[model samples]
Target: MKITTIETFVLGERQLLVRIGTDVGLAGWGDATLEHRPGTVAAAIREMSGHLIGTDPLPVTRHWQRLARGGFYRGGPVLGSAVAGLDIALWDLRGRFYGAPIHELLGGPCRDRVRLYTHALSARPEHTGEPDRARALVAAGYTLVKAAISGPVGFLDSPRQTARFVRDLEALREAVGDEADFGIDLHGRVSPHHARRLADAVAHTGPAFLEEPLRPEHSRLIGQLTATTSIPIATGERLYSREEFLPVLQAGIAIAQPDLAHAGGITEVFRIATLAESFDVQVAPHCPLGPVALAACVQVDLAVPNFYAQEHVIDLRSADSRDLRLLTGPEVLVPVAGHLDRPTGPGLGIEIDEDAVRAAHRDDLLVPRGTPRWSHPDGGFAEW
Candidate 1:
């Protein structure tokens, strides 16, 4: 069926959802949220729609190549995220048209259930609730939890700051003991020297991994840091393509964390997973957006043989929450004992609650969230 129209919805809470209507009355939805830049991504999606209107939505990959590579200046977060939403929508449409899930279209399931991980504690380093939060997550049946480091650090912070960061992780470990695995998310806010220092200091805690120990720009130095620590290094929420992932995979990352919503959606993330598999690295798609993005990630997690844990912000323990409010079939995604089972429904498996989506948009309830800004004591801008 030809794509009759493409529309974008700026839902509350910094979400951008795209709906592609087919001539045959089938419509597919996908999340194109880019955190602080949903509006810009929406504009990009509208711009790319010029090539998609009145075209076949079945040859998903061909369209991906045309939209993703056809542009003379292509493949940054904006274009990548725009293409990602459209690609995911096209996949959803194709899956529904074929009466199969996206994973089945890829090659059937590789595992019965996909393991998932959620965050614990506030990103603020000084937050004192890590242990309590960790215990709460463990009680909720999540065996893996990740927490970010304190907001910002200088090139060489004091020994006191370093020790505080270490202590925070130590507290989390103590709370869960050996019952669960915890990861340290540096959030690409540390300098190289301090990243190694923090990595060295926390090595004794035995975290599941060190996520984004250094920014993507410093990926060339990742190998050095990986060699210095036994903890698995995971990054790539900012990376958009397989070519961008190759260098970091070569740098000895143990896990690749491509955000399905931002990294070319199911098509590119599956390819990234395959590339990581060749290097003996595992795939744990980075998804902190809405249900559509999580559903897309689950489909990939089920299809890829080298799949690792999936990252999500969904409160799986909650029967009803903001993440679940937008979906009609949240049960299809809720994890049982920290693992999501295979879905039998077509497309992304969970159906969007169109009324709820429209209400969220109409009421402007999502608050248009963006990344918070931070500055050091001396008044210089710091990573947030």
Candidate 2:
């Protein structure tokens, strides 16, 4: 059937949905929501829809190329995110048309289940110290957990700040012991010098990986940091395309964490995973968004052989159960003993609660402006 129309919907405050209607009454749904840039991304989706209006949805690769390189200037957050939503919807449509899951089309399952890691954000470092929460996560069935250690480092901070960061990580290691794997996210707050120092201090902690120790633009520094520390360096949430990932991977970085929604959706991410695999790099699939995005990531996880693990924002699952309840398939990404089973249902395997999504759509629910500024002791703006 030929494509008929494309519609974009902004639901649940930050949820951006794309519906691609075909002549055969089969419609595809995708999530293109960016944390704070939903409006801009939605507009990009609408603009890209002009290219997809009358095309066949089956040639997914051709469509992806058209949307990606069709433009003279391609591959950024808005364009990549917009294409990501459409690519997922197209894949979902293809799966439904063939009466098989996306994983089957991608050469079947590599594993029965996909393991996941949870995000831990602490307001008060002392109140929610690493040791106390590490035990709780392990007990709650998580083999992997990521914690933000340094809030924001200044250009010229005291040795005391560095000591505190090291102490917290030590406490975490003590709580989890050697059995559990943990990751530390510097959040790109530390400079090259500080990053090197901090990496040295926490070298013995055996972090599964150290993430975004430096800013995205300073990616060349990753090679330096990787050389200095044995810990695996992980980054790329801010990065958009395969081109952006080339240097990072070539630098001998261990993990490539591409956000499913922000990267080029399932279509582009599948290519990204393949590229990383060629370089002997593993994928974690960065996803702190909603259920649809998580479902999309899990589908990729099942099909990709080089997938390392999945990152999830467990808080959203608790806060928006109604939206999450839409996932009622046998292969739903349910956390069982700290791991998620591969989805078996047709398409992306998760259904959308249109009513619930629309109900939660409000201007106030979006991330607020000027939320808070985190700074270092020397008045330098720190990464948040």
Candidate 3:
């Protein structure tokens, strides 16, 4: 059957969902982590729909190439994210048509379950040091957790700020002990000077990885930092395409973290993972968005041999939460002991509750515009 129409829904303030309708009454859903830019991505999808309106959904690769390389200027957040949503929907449609899951269509699963590492809500370094939250996560059966350390260090912060950052990590290490794995996210807020000092201080804590120690543009600096520290360097949430990831990967960065929603959906992320595998680098697919995006990540995680632990928000633990059951049908991403089992249902394996999604949609609910900024005590601009 041919694709007939493409529809989009922006719901829950920042979530963007795409539904592709086909002539055979089979529709597929996909999520794009556009947040505030949902409308922009949606417009891009609408513009590109002309190329896919009458095409067969079975040939995913051809469709991906036609929409991606078909354009003279290709591969950025807007185009990649827009294509990502469509690509996922197409894959889901293909799986449903064949009565199999996406992973089976990709080459079947290599493992029964996928490991996940979720983020804790504590933002301040001091707050993360408390054992109560760590204990709560552990008791909930999570073996891996990540906390944001060093909120917004200036380019040239005093030794006291650095000391506090180190002390915070030290406290968290002491609280969690060796029983569980903990990671620190610099959030690209640290300057190279401070990043070096911070990395040197926390190297002893044995963090699972140092996430986005510097901004995505600082590739050369990231290489320098990677060389200076024993801690594994993880990045790529800001990166949207394979071309953008080449430099970071070639620099010998240990971990590649590509968000499923922004990094060209399952089609390109699978390719990105394979490319990372070729370079002998591990992958930890960045997923801080909704349930649909998480479900998409698990499909890729199941097939990729060089897969690393998945990143999730700790708040998803509450079964009664709206985000927990955002999608309809079976719980595609079931977390157990800090890991998620591969879904056994057809298509993406989880169905979207159209009614719930439509009801959640609100015009006032929109992604915050502009870059969110944070600052140090010295009044210098910091990353957010």
TM-score of each: 0.96, 0.92, 0.94
Q: Show where candidate 1 strays beyond 4 Å.
A: 123-125, 362-369
Each model's lDDT = 0.87, 0.80, 0.80
| Clash pairs for candidate 2 | none
- Model 3 Cα lDDT, one tens digit per residue, 47-157: 989888988899999898987788899888888888899999899899899999999999999899998877655644444444567767777777777888645566866
Query: Which lDDT tens digits does candidate 2 get at residues 62-90?
Result: 99899888999988888988988999889
Residue 46 displacement (Å), model 3: 1.3
Residue 126 in model 1: shift from native, Å? 1.6
Instruction: Please give the RMSD of candidate 1 to the true structure.
Output: 1.8
Candidate number achieving the greatest TM-score relative to the actual structure: 1
Q: Which stretches of candidate 2 lie over 4 Å from their true place?
A: 12-14, 125-129, 315-323, 326-331, 363-371, 376-380
Please rank every candidate by lDDT, starting with the best: 1, 3, 2
Sort by TM-score, top down from the best: 1, 3, 2
TM-score result, candidate 2: 0.92
List pairs with backbone clashes in candidate 3: none
